[model samples]
Target: MTINLTEYGLKQTIQKTITATEQPRLGRVIEQHRELYQLITATGQRQAQVTGKLAHQATSATAFPAVGDWVLFSAGDDYTTLIDRILPRQSVLARGAVNQHDGQIIATNIDTIFICMSLNADFNVRRVERYLTIAWDSGAMPVLVLTKADVCTDRADKLRALADVTVGVPTVMCSAETGEGLEDLQPYLTAGQTVAFVGSSGVGKSTLINRLLGATVLATKTIRQDDDKGRHTTTSRQLLPLPSGACVIDTPGMRELQIFVGDLQQTFAEITALAADCKFNDCTHTSEPGCAVQAAVADGRVSLERLQSYQKLQREMSYQGLNSRQLEQAKIQRMFGGKQAMKRVKQRYHRD
Candidate 1:
């Protein structure tokens, strides 16, 4: 039952950790079902649960091992394994937890993220932008995948709409039914690479993964004819290997994607660049005079819709439980000299 660890993206860094540790064996988490986990090692797949010490040390859900995390474990007596430690993640995709200030880990150690959206009734440019922000901040490349292209009549228009927001990010039009644009994803699906598919329900993430795996490994449900919304078929995160030697993590559909810790500047680069030319250092861009962002909107360089989207995401990030004082100080430091920046931030807080 032993399998090659290389197919699961075992690298020198993980090997070093394994070599350094003596008591625990190395394994990669393949599936997560609440507190239960399924890990794959050189021996084979085994059911696992985190050790009591590991659980007690976790302050939040994000601190626990996620589907793509590599961990140290020990064999238990009854065909179970005890996960002792989680190795450092190379990259992580996380988002703000629902109604909570803490972050939720979507997948860890992912090399690439596929932000899938159906070109039908489920398509939304703003949601895609939110996914891109988290993906960019995750230290992984984000590739936009437009699914159900066979049903969409206005593919060109939809691509045009995504052009300004997506910018340099690559977009691939795919149809699981017709196998279109599946081959274009091969470059990112190379052997030993891990990719996670994320989007709302009915976006065909499971279907796309099935097509890539060349088997119906993940369950999928039909979309409702009225709203085009599909039921949640994949209830939990699971990493499955493809015939191509790459691994794909299929996640449950996220209905609402709140901002976690991500770089707004990177997500909205066009607006960030424009802000540099603003008349005031702290121009809010709403009604500020000499606002480069507004000017661009007026001059047709930046769309009003895009600017509004940027402003909305900025507001979301601002209130996502990150230290407000630190955020202000960082902004001031970016605008003024160090000491003067701290002084200005204090004065601004005092004024408010």
Candidate 2:
């Protein structure tokens, strides 16, 4: 008798690389430990594991398969067969690795990125600009989803601000409660297509997904009145198959986003384009004789905050070297930048 992988939800499915172990096995990554990953095979759903060699070879997070990635792997009855290779990705959503100076894969093979933001205190055009740069660098199309439109006093004003920041990207305003503008999402979420949501918490990610699903597969929560930030409701990354023959991956809210140094230029296309007009080949846009970038900023063509954010990310990534010591320092700084004064006081007391 022949076994069919589809029956077991193990057929042609998108899965993330979890881990690779060599002591007891010799295969690569087939499943991930990210908890939110679901694997499909020719037979049915399968638990994924990896071989040790790939684990040893992974120098960065991007080297591993992220959510929305399709990989080929063998299967055993108990654990999944070791992964042999990661299939080609159509699109990827990545951010700078936390503490490490490398690029981390947020999700892979994404066809579209839903840039969600709330209409309340959570809205920040600077943040949207930062995200757009990374999204443009990721080789994926970005779609801005402004949620909580019902709460906003003037929806048009809020959307116009977002439109100004995102330039060429398509922006949509939707209220999960009223299902307003939900139909606008259908063009991208067609059958066999994959879409991923990238935004901070309290942006109505789960609420929107629940609306898209026509049911409540994902949980939703209310944000605190003071902070206007979601309660980090979606803790892990998980992909769900929508009834409309599309797939969606929802991830946890990120507080701070760092950009990979190598991709900064690609992400900031406007700056790079403007730099071409610079008189000097290596214009820093500060005090250069013919700095087109600075000229644009001066002329109000480019926002000063946007350029500064780009430069800030570049410097942060540059300082975060690949070495272990640099990585440790970056981690500590990221986790404790706000409490450095108190930290120093405590350290001095302990030493005394």
lDDT of each: 0.83, 0.67
Candidate 1, which ten residues in sequence have the lowest lDDT sum? 329-338
Which tens-of-lDDT digit does each residue in 1-352 have in candidate 1? 7788889987764565444454238889999888899999888898899988989976566768889998889867776789987766668788888766556789988889999999998888989889998888787899999999999999999998898778889999999999999999999999999999999987999999999988888899989998888788889999988888889999999888888666677878999999999999889899989999999999999988888988888888734444768755433322222444346445654554
Measured on C-alpha atoms, candidate 2 has an lDDT of 0.67
For model 2, how does the per-residue alpha-carbon lDDT over 163-218 read when each residue is reduced to its tens digit?
54666778888899998889889998887677789898778999899999888888
Judged by lDDT against the true structure, how good is candidate 1? 0.83
RMSDs, each prediction? 8.5, 12.6
| Model 2 stretches astray by more than 4 angstroms | 1-37, 76-80, 261-267, 317-352
